[model samples]
Target chain A: MKKVEAVLIDLSGTLHIENTATPNAVEALKRLRASRVKIKFVTNTTKESKTVLYQRLKKLGFDISQEEIFTSLSAANDLIKKDQLKPMLIVDDAALEDFSDVSKFDGKPDSVVVGLAPEKFNRPVLNEALRLLLSGGKLVAIHQGRYYKTSSGLSLGPGPFVKLLEYAAGVEAVTVGKPNVEFFKAALEDLGVADPTTAFMIGDDVRDDIDGAQRLGLKGCLVQTGKYRSGDETKISPPPDLVLGDFSNAVDQILSHIGQS
Target chain B: MLVRVLSISIGSTLLRGTCNHISSFTVKRLKSQASNMDGVKGLLIDISGVLKDGDVVIDGSVAAIKKLQSANFPFRLVTNETLKPRKTILSTLSMLGYNIDEKILFSPVPATVEILKRENLRPHLLVHPRMIPEFEGVDFNDPNCVVMADAYEHFTFENMNACFRKLMAMENPVFISLGIGKYYMDDDGMALDVGGFAKCLEYATGVSPRVVGKPSRDYFLAAVNDMNLKCDQVVMIGDDVLHDVGGAQAAGLKGALVRTGKFTKRDENHPTVKPDLIVNNLAHAVELLFGTSPS
Candidate 1:
């Protein structure tokens, strides 16, 4: 165990599973903040705008600041800005707020930004995206995670449609979120952590949160909640540094591990 | 050469034996060719948009079906139209001057009946008035399943709320949707199908319904199995990409898209519903299958 400089916590499964926060997560987050640990909340949720997401987290009693929340939509916004790209955004109507700065119009565009907009995934809309790509427009995916857990069951996420555009347009989408090194690195960089080895990445998803962070020299902890299936630890190579029960347990482990170091 | 074997099987016993052997070889060749299918043995045709839009049969539909019959291709109409019973549907087809059989028409009614019996479930039918006769013998007194279809006027707020209560109260109650079609073309325009409401119930109850029509793999398999052909051997011809083309292909059956009803140029490029073949109409799909000029 080492003194963790900053922590990148996964939001969806780790802190909250769709709206309702995980048991004891609010208390755990309060303790982490009290401990003066530099914490940033990261998510691959491209469904809603950051403002709405922030409001939701605030209502759910997480006490997270809007600046501390790092969403894929925000990451995609940064990528769009950095590249100085005019993009056709195909995200949820509520999520359109995140891309208001970007120029959006009919006819041709430089890139096609896609996210989870179930109603917008029809034939005409997708075809428009395809035609743009065929004409050499860039395909930018917010996050290419396959399916997301809903209260009902697993529903198709933006990944399938993103892949569809990729297959049809014969172009590889530039993914700008989770499991992408740049997204994780950007979060840590914001916290003024030059060395990722001093940071810990905690999440329920083994590949995106744990394994991805581990590759970038960060200590990764797998929390068995939110989309965590049985035998997930076995699915990853060079297993996570620690596997804990839930977000509450994970917080306890993080504190003890930091003390030992 | 393969077409003759179908007729020869019913001729002389000696010829039947020879035809059986030849047909098996041809079917085996078809199975191999199925990997990169240049031809198909049978068809699972869609009725509504492909054949007729609303009450009126599309022009050349009768001729195309007759040509398919003469060509000796084992075909069946796999439709999601659960609004009407079998007798009414058959009468309508016959009136339209197309010769069709009750056995070859695989709609969702019989499948619904079979499911009710197999699962030992009772029906709480939220369907069309015409569809009421289809669930004749099913017990409705002790409702254990919420059967949803295009009930139109019957799909009122009061009925849906009642069904919702029944679904919520029962332990592991089944939600049966005849077809999860987003909408269908009526004489007026596009009208809502059961899909949106099915999704509503799913969102409310947090349980996905068992779809027993069109896109469901089991439903497609039933029609494919009835023809005694492998999924690869049959080609589904329809207009809708999600239900008709994607459904069939997902069920291991090849799919051909017809740009007739609800079909736009974009459907050809939709990666999820990318049909194996795209044609102008049902006639063109049939011609592509048989490699012959329409008589």
Candidate 2:
């Protein structure tokens, strides 16, 4: 095992499950902070704005700062600014506050940016996005997650719709969130870590977080907590470097492994 | 008066360039049938929203059908209604003074039945009671698959959970969704459609359900293939923007959205699912396709 330089942690399944914190997750995070190891929290949540998400995390008692967070929505905002696009936004209404700085929706847009908006996934809206794509508009998908767990149950995410538009428009959307190496690289650069191999990605999702990070030279740690169906580790090839019970266990493994190294 | 554009020959290049101009300019009515010599081979029309809402037919819809018949142009009725059998639907239309042939009426239930039989699947049925007759001979006991449609009262928490487990259990049971609609207009008001529940199950199991209804390329192609015409040679006229017009356009056919049934003012000039033509109603749609309205 190699000594971990900086740790990139997942949010939903790793630190908390839905609105509540995972068992002893807060205390474990405090211990990790005490160890002097750099940490950054990342998420693929498209349901709410970054400010609102930060408020929820604060209420849950996690000692996280605004700069320590790297959300898919934030990454999408960067991409939109880089391209200087006037986009037709197809995202959750609650998440609109996050993009107040860059939104320029005026019927005819240069791009169609999509996220998970349950009500907006209706025929007219989706068709509008599709039509825009066919007529020389770029499609920017924040994250292509197949589905996510909600309070009621598992619900459809933005992945299927992204695929639908791709199929219909004969064009591919530029994915800007998790599993995209650029997104991970951006977080690593922010931490001033040049070598990605020393960073460990701890998450519950096998594909989006663990496998994706491992492919980019980060050590992958799979946590069996939120949305972890049985046999998830087997689903990914060149499996996770470490499999732990939860974030608390993941912290212990990282500490011991670094000490041994 | 309505005017159908010769959309196929114009190509998408001309359509995109002239879209704004066409929208701004009002189409002129043709006084004689000789002026209606467009190369459009067939018509694919929707029934529920364009013609009637429940048992009551919309005004001028009968005249619209009469106009189509008198013009001697070929047309087919395409619908995504999964609540009733085809015979019952045809009978209801006949009783409502609609002269429709059994062969020309296309719905999702029959195609779904064919898919089930071809795959040798025993599915847990989740559709309306009236729709059960369409799958009479198919297996349903101790199901290995889940079949979902607009089954208003049959959708239960336990049933959906059971189906989700079947998909996630590594056996890889198939999930079949007939129509992925959020809601529909029935006799009462807007009612929940099967799409929400189906999307939930899809999200849980991480399996993309096979949509057998409108907006699916297979559904639109099935109608076009039956008519023995190239997709570009046909025009689809319906009320729903996505399911009817968007689906048809995706399948390479010209789509026309009628301002009837569930159509709103916003739909006429929608940025994405823009129809090649926008008509007032079925009467207007018929006049556009042919040269004149019903006498």
Candidate 3:
């Protein structure tokens, strides 16, 4: 019920699903924009770069700028730069543009950064990653989502693969995306918002998005779209502050609470 | 049981009378004898190291079994060896001069088969090829369970990845590992055990496998229950302190660590587990229990 100052939105399954925008989502975002509320698009989508994602959003008729979008790819890039790590990237080719500035190690890498790279999920590549890990390199998982929703059906996420490497090498991976506390804190820091209670995070994932944000004092609004299955709300304790039908419904509730509707 | 208790109290009194000059070693031995003398009606013996190491039987091990048979003591050969089927293991022991009965032998294969049948679970087996016949009647269509053991050279990345995908596809994955041992002594020195590979799938799927071998309390209890004896009335003898002694103790059974096969002096003074008895070999354990020199 508190007045919303900043709102964090999830891109996939909330705003659009594979080049198609959610029903009434564009109009709902426009209404929130008119209220002069600061917004940042926080997504765990690692299959594509920020530019391609931004262009897709623009094409879908949503007025989202590239600067307003925060991705797990960007978080991984920040970590790579901060640590000065020469990593062997196991990510999709489309998502490579984001890590163009990062240097590659000639031999065994100092670290391994993994995402949803279907082509690289084979034995040889996984074995190579295992060798690198056994040789003292660390593993960095962009996100550990168990599964993601696609047009055909649900598909395997990078979580299982990440776990495979961790178990084989007897090492723990450093997760860089939701619902990691540092990922949420990094987005809040970028928005210049000191009070997390004033901001709201809207996403379809009960564990990663809703429970993740709620743990850090941010009010979570779980939308019943995207990767959400029935009874997902019961999976977490002190369930999400708001559970709505879709992203548009969640926005309507937020705007009405702040007297902006 | 009452006679054993009376003997221990009399022994304690005699040791205390001579306590003025008794060494620390004597006191330690006295304490171990006191604890082990109470109601040890049966035993769950390990096969690989205690009875025979590889194809060669340990000295006096066969005679020790004969002595236990003559006394009508109930015991079972409990093993975590998954490389061979239960029949093959029994035959090997038989050739090595130890006459072990097929009914009294317990291994992970038959135990896992019972679980699969009880749960009506179809399994995608990642076990050695030689152990296949043991699971003859179990369904393998549309696998809802993953059963892993020492696959040796078959522990390829492709096989592991295939199993990984199968588990991920299930609504609720059921993973069953034969044992949780880290490593074991083989012909080629020490080799990685099934636990390492099982850990990979467990880490990936976030599902802990049901271990059906040593260190699992259920496995030890199942063996103890077969002897028609309570946990406190049984003792487990093994070479590996952590899995055998520590596991048996955790399951409410007394554990005796024998100084044979894969055992080092370090196991005698293990940091975590204080074994109830530390004997030279299976013969020494039998001598302490039956008060007769089997050798």
Candidate 4:
């Protein structure tokens, strides 16, 4: 009953760490895309916009269009639509501006959608949002992912700041990014697939991507090329379904798993 | 009587009769209310930092549970209280002055037992020997499930070795224990939880035992099911992030972290677990749940 519809490749650690592909990242995507497998590059990292991320991935040797990339930004936009509420506050940021096509909130958002926005996380902004939230505004966080690796070193992701905002606001959020069912649902809908098992999530991190896929009953392939290595598999408390060297061999494994079913 | 009539007939008889006879106006109002809650399903709440902090529960936390119950807000205690049996644990919370519905209490003990039965265990228990009085009907030979309750004196190194032996023999043998942490309470100060012991055995075995208590996803799911709430509708109440928030997230439940009891910045940022919302304590979490600001 399982048919290959799409292959959702994780951005950081899965495909490329920063400017370099993890071994066979480009070739695997090329082979999969060539074989008519729909490709959607999903990333929990929202440090950059779709355009910047696409450019970055291209430099790393993977050919990806903006149409096939589903970032936390994309997920947040979809959440706003699904929730059917607009904000009154003027969101002055490039990430917020991306949803200019959609209707804007009239005055102060009934809910604030949070992703990995770099500039907007501060005590002042958080306090302002806290007031709105205390007055019954819902907060939707993209994911609880905390850290993301960069060319320089490890930096805190949007989740930490979002958590700070949550502390100030004192309101729990509805998350939409990685491991959240909605994120997977959106990707699968884009891929035109029904079940999650038909898809395989290949990532370097055990917790964020691979384990997340296992929760959804999807076959997860943990690649030892990025943040973690082959021996580091012991660290993942709840381990992944399968372990692989890197994405170069991932295509063959994915093809076989999907084919066997 | 209404109750008698409801219980006399077979399933759906009362529902079909009562539901069909409602006035059109009332039906319209109900329909509107239903539509307002179109996508709003039951909340799957993680219990730890959101409700009770160690022994000191958040102010009005119990009252908030009462209010939610009155409003028909389907809530359950998705706790990873693997140390105590479900019935005993809930009753203890009740005796300790927390007004919780036992029907909605889904601890890992019963589910762990069910899993044990499925695995064909010889009733090899790592629980308090005194507590073994509860399992009169439960078999003792070739016990497949090894459960350890840390609160009792059963949490000794010898008991640990016995449990480990059972686990090592069985492939993926079910190991259900209480929260693996330490707590200092009013009466019970300086207590070691089962989590540390589970870690020790797991390190030795390399076979990570399935923790069924708070922070374990299985208990959360069971509690959600018991409350008749959808996974998305319930908000978890807990004070500890490692046992409460982490487990809730793992079980696909939302968490509200209350900075009470053993919650410090260290516990809040404890390595891997992340809580969705943070509050002063259980009382503050309740205020957020009820659309009110903490006083």
Candidate 5:
């Protein structure tokens, strides 16, 4: 119940394996609780709802609430507000947590925000997008990465269609997620952390979590336990400062590095 | 070498499109298979300006059909008649004294619907409102994305927006029309075609529509295929380049534009597309296709 000076946690690879909680993650949280370090879990898994994500973590032994979970899909409401955009076309799951109340465009949208819609790629959708873009409709693609891996297999993320629209329109889109500074800025600001020099970012993806932190002048750690594949480390635009085996190792080092361990 | 192209006028046959002027094109001839001259020869003919006076058929046009039949050569009717079916059109033509059967006429509607069925879209119609009587048998309950037939202020944003109730969380369906041109009724000079309403939906949803009529290959081939001939053996005739000539080319058939329709003679030299042959009118086209026309 007590908010702490710092939150040291990982969402996917470290605190949980695949979609389940890692062993001792709850105990590690108890230790962080004793130290009064705020334990925040952030993830980019935009596919699942917050409740489902929290349930997965709970099933893995972490006693967490929905409020402590931060997934990219959760930011839809804030993002739509921040952009001051309405009449938006969503290339995402028909149902989303924060997107429950937004109005669907009558027929076409003022802008297209392609996040992650895996099911609705028929000619109507694609060609309608093409038609709008051809007729000068604006688009906002999340990130340009084509594919991302999970515990099971590689999946087609939102990046492929995002880039597809870009090619068709010959116009670029404003990004709104990981690897983009907006997400980092908002997350750090929400954490009430004033100094970036003392901050550390722990994530499994090298390009998004690590390079994204590095670009913002934060200590970036790549966790080898989750989402790390052979030759993927080589693809990071800027290498991370540290590459640890897991979240436990990264958080331990981070707490000690900031003189709070 | 006599090659008849649809829509392209006889004086200077050109593709009907944005460029409606008299221009020229460099003709590239394929290897002359004329040794036996026994191969197939495709002929393109128009129905409205060339054959009819609005529900009245020209007797000479019927004679033209017989003459082409007498030559042991087959001809294809490539028209943009969206209001009726092939059999009905043929029967009407027969009653009006044209010597043609159902094998010659092509209507873009049913063929476009079939081609679009493969896409499994819920279409919105924008045809004439009076035409709905003919569609009493049509199923509006299936894939009810968007449908507009002859809209007379009835296809307004308010009425169309009501569809947002069921179509929410789903992309808008395509608006298929026979053609995209300024339509007229009685004395009203100009009204936006279905394409205009389709554009409004596109602007509102960031989704444009898929046009299934005119230049659509599905419709072109369906028209040509009704004749039971190879696609290469059919020719397309129309008054618009985008609707007639370009549609034919996209369907792998040759196309021509008559100077009579929305486009003029200058459409012939469009850099990207050109018709195979140009003629003064359908009568001259008949003479060229039935006599010593070169393929």
Candidate 6:
């Protein structure tokens, strides 16, 4: 009902699934941009760097630039730089390019940064992380998602692993990604959007994307794609403001509300 | 028995002035009935604080235990010590000149094993390395549950993560913790206990663990039932007020707080829990129960 000045788009399940973009997503995004509404791509995909993700989106024919994407990896990197921390990164090799400026792990670390690194989730690496935590090192989780949609099926996220270190060391980790309110606020701060109500977040996750945006007074549009299961609408109270078939439908609804359709 | 009569007389006398607030006759009758019917029949003794403080035997504890044995009283050493097996605990007590029988010792390890068998659940153990022998013959492959104890040095990230993954994979996860104590006195001094590690797994998996040790109602009742005694007919003696005294009182058993080992003045004036009895030491509690000094 309110005039939508800015829009936050979710990648992965909402726009594309790995290599392929969702049906009509590229064209819908182009149409929305023509409406002159400010757009920012907010994602919790911690598996790869922002450059790689941008490259993938470009390959999928989405007319997106690197500056428009705000990822959990970017948030974590900002936090690491702000804190001036010497961190021990437990992230994927592909994601390491983003943290090139930070100091490397030298057995003794001041913080332990965690993301989705399937290969590094073994005992020896985890034990080292545990010891660091026990010795009073901080834990920074990129995101606390339980699971995410993949080509095969749903796979485990870094949330459980983050909790493992937190529990064993008797410390609480600082999560830097959705549905953490600070993450959403940070993206809006970057866009210089002071009034959160003027923006809408379009994503597939009921909790992280939809509920997270709503908590900050932004309208949430949950698309039934990427990690969405049937009956997901009933999971959250005061359910998603808009539940549509996919990202394209979500765009259509937003455009029509703003008289851009 | 004498202690019960003494408590009744004191209680009735204290309630005499509060007749307007409560029915005095009913109070007297209830106290009389309780004193006449129920008396302490068995004792649940804490080992670490009451008997020995980290391998050093408390003064007069051995003699007090001997006195209890000679008097033919039924008692069990209820301990949350999961770092060692029952055999190791027995040997440690024996070496300290406190002759304790293995049959009367009650630790969470054996109780947890029973729970696993009863529930038909296989466990992925996150306990100490030395304590694994106690879980012999139990299936450990493709575990449906997680059993955590004081793994001490074994509380590594890898082990905790493995247990976390196992619990996450299960449709219905089962997590069992031996004890949930925050910290305990070890040789080095106060060290982190199993509860922190258990809390870690619980937080990660969103599974509330079934505690099989001190403070759990089932654990206290199990120890009482093992002595073939009713809940009201037993007393628990320990240094920790919240776990031992508070837990036992909550389970319908009388609790005695001993001023030894980890006991502090704060526990004496605990905000919530009022210990049923307070004594100087295990020897003092035994003297109060038997109405005589240990010979």
Every prediction: chain A TM-score = 0.95, 0.96, 0.96, 0.84, 0.83, 0.96
In candidate 2, what are the lDDT values of residues B178-260, reduced to their tens digit?
Answer: 97776544454444566756766665566778898889987887788788898888889898888789988998898887667
> Which of the numbered candidates is closest to the native, going by highest DockQ?
6
TM-score to native of every candidate shown: 0.56, 0.61, 0.75, 0.45, 0.48, 0.76
All models: lDDT? 0.78, 0.78, 0.83, 0.62, 0.57, 0.82
Docking class of 6: incorrect
lDDT of 6 by residue, B161-255 (tens): 67777886788899998988665445644466676667656755569989999999889888887888999999999998999999999999998
Task: Give the higher-DockQ candidate: 2 or 5.
Answer: 2
- Candidate 3: DockQ? 0.13
DockQ of 5: 0.02
Interface RMSD of 5: 13.8
Q: Across residues A150-222, which tens digit of lDDT does each residue of candidate 1 receive?
A: 7764455676667656655568889988888888899998898889998999998888888888999899899
Q: Best-fitting candidate, measured by TM-score? A: 6
Q: Write the per-residue lDDT of candidate 4 for residues B1-295, one digit (tens) a residue.
A: 9987776454334222222233345334333433222333455444554455555454555676777777786666665555456567666577657777666665556555555555565557766554555454567776666666553455443455556567756765766654444332224233334554555455434455566666667667666766567666655657667667776777776766655555665765778877676555444444455554333
Against the true structure, whose lDDT is highest?
A: 3
TM-score of chain B of each: 0.76, 0.76, 0.83, 0.65, 0.67, 0.80
Tens-digit lDDT track for model 2 on A23-96? 89999999899888889988888878878778888999999998788889999999999998998888888999
Reproduced native contacts, each prediction: 0.00, 0.04, 0.12, 0.00, 0.00, 0.11
- State the displacement of the C-alpha of residue B89, model 4, in Å, after optimal TM-score superposition: 47
Interface RMSD of every candidate? Answer: 10.7, 7.9, 5.1, 16.7, 13.8, 5.7
In model 2, residue pairs whose N, Cα or C atoms come closer than 3 Å (at least 3 residues apart or on different chains), thus clashing, are A128-B272
